[model samples]
Target: MTRAAVALIYRRTDNSGTQLLFIQRARREGDPWSGDMAFPGGRMQPEDASPRATAERETLEETGLDLGRHGRFRARLSDLITRHHSRWRPMVVTPYLYEWKGPKAVTLNHEVEHLVWVPLDFLAAEENQGRRPWRTPLGTLNMPCCRYQDYCIWGLSYSMVQELLAQGLP
Candidate 1:
């Protein structure tokens, strides 16, 4: 099985609320997750010492956010498995949570088309949670997700949020 890692970066607001950072992947042909909302991450490279290291490196490479310089490791959410399908292979993904203490401005690389800081409160609200039908390589299916503005957080990203919420906010 393949393994990957992602950084779930968040920050505390002046009003005591928290916001989590997400990236909109740039569209590309043959990319299964193209144009989808996701965290800063990618498949583990040989140089990575651990999953945490992969998350840190990917965050910096994709967003120009130096987690090592401004992030505090908070928790490791549950590892999630991607569904096996004809167009995609199953993989395991480890998620590392980080509290960001740096500037709000981010320098995105080519992999990321846009970024959004979504409030924790907004995600936890029941009204904002629902299942949306998505057409995949298999067929159209109703998938659980959280909608924020024009982006929809689903699949592994959504599972990570659920795990984080279940573990209680830090």
Candidate 2:
């Protein structure tokens, strides 16, 4: 069966421009997606009332940011699914989006190794587009990606950003 997940998209405005929060997962031998840059989210729990609730809960668990208290949440963006080599059995994953209110620095849990607040304008730039050969245990091939300094946003994470772009930028 396909598993369900949700992510909280936190964005904020500054004199420079709007930025989005991204978390880098800590590398663990057992994690299929270890060390990947991703949004704050995870699989839905039985206790979660809805996809949005799952997103809110995971955001708090991963970043110590409570969307209900310190932030405003909008159920914007559409769901995205990807088949991944997860620890779980054969599955497709659904990711729902909840955008947080403002630019708040994050306090990450052990599950995260780093945090990146990517500028929206950087994502919209054509110069940032490129392809690179990425090797995973599964194999290697050139793939579409966006580079920002030491980070490369690709795979399903790239898909989500594409959706965000398609929705039109401010």
Candidate 3:
């Protein structure tokens, strides 16, 4: 089965609050998740020793944030499997949580359009939880999502976020 990994990079704010980083993938032809908001990650490569390695490597390549050198490993959320009707074949997604201790500078690569640091409280608040329409091969359906500013976090990424929230912050 296909597998992938994502890094849920977070940091503590000045007021002792937490913020999670999210990235908007660059729009590109033939890309299923183009322009979608998601955590920094990608499909696992053969050279990756573990899912954690895939997450760290992808995060660094997409956002230029060296999680391997500057991040502290935290909780590991439950694996999420893509639905059959997803753009691609069903795949196992491993979400790795990390507390970023790196610099403020972020140099995004072509894979990423832009990145945002969303407050954990904002994500946890019930008021921010809502649904958004998603177009699937079957039909357009309203999917549970989190509305953050102009971005809507949904699908597998949303599932991972819910899993993280269910387990509470580390």
Candidate 4:
């Protein structure tokens, strides 16, 4: 089965410049991306009218922020397809960009393990660039990663950040 998923790439601006919200997924045994840092989102549900709605809905459910009420929908960003094919189900994800003025507080739901506000400038720093070890059935290999303090942002989360940067937002 092919699934459609959506994510919200939320940015906040103030006197301190801009920062993005990233969440660490809670550890779950069967989840492929468990404990990974990612934008708040998930598979599309029946009630979601479109991919945007899916993003908005998931954002609310995961972060307790009603994007419809709190965020200014900017523009739709890039859509990413699953690079590694799965024998079971595959997914395509569309990300929506939303900007919030001033500062915002996040109240994470159970689906999230932790939340980190990633400073835009930190991402551009050369020191933040590193590699993370990814273990597969074959062996462990180092994958490109961005580190902030103790949190390591890599894989799809890193790719999404690249897309957002490519749009000339920061």
C-alpha lDDT of candidate 4 relative to the true structure: 0.77
Q: Write one digit per residue (lDDT tens) for candidate 4, span 112-167.
A: 99988888888867888899999888999999889987788998778878777767
Tens digits of per-residue lDDT, candidate 2, 51-140, equal: 668777888889887776766655456556555565435544455544566446677899999888788788779999888687877999
Model 3 ranges with Cα > 4 A deviation: 83-88
Strongest candidate by lDDT = 1
Local distance difference test, each candidate? 0.90, 0.73, 0.89, 0.77
- Give a tens-digit lDDT track for model 1, residues 1-170: 77889999999999999999999999988877788899999888889999899999999999999999999999888888874333377888899999999987789999999999999988889999989788866999999999999999998899889888878865
- lDDT-better candidate, 1 vs 4: 1
| Per-candidate TM-score against the hidden true structure | 0.93, 0.84, 0.93, 0.86
Write the candidate numbers in order of decreasing TM-score: 3, 1, 4, 2
What would the per-residue lDDT of candidate 3 be over residues 93-150, giving only the tens digit for each residue?
8999999998999889999999999898898899999988878779999999998999
TM-score of 4: 0.86
- CA-only RMSD, every prediction: 1.8, 2.6, 1.8, 2.5
Off by over 4 Å in 1: 83-89
Highest-TM-score candidate: 3
The TM-score measured for candidate 3 stands at: 0.93
Candidate 1 vs candidate 2, TM-score winner: 1
Task: Give the Å error, residue 34, model 2.
Answer: 1.4
Rate residue 43 of model 2 by lDDT: 75
Query: On lDDT, who's better, 2 or 4?
Result: 4
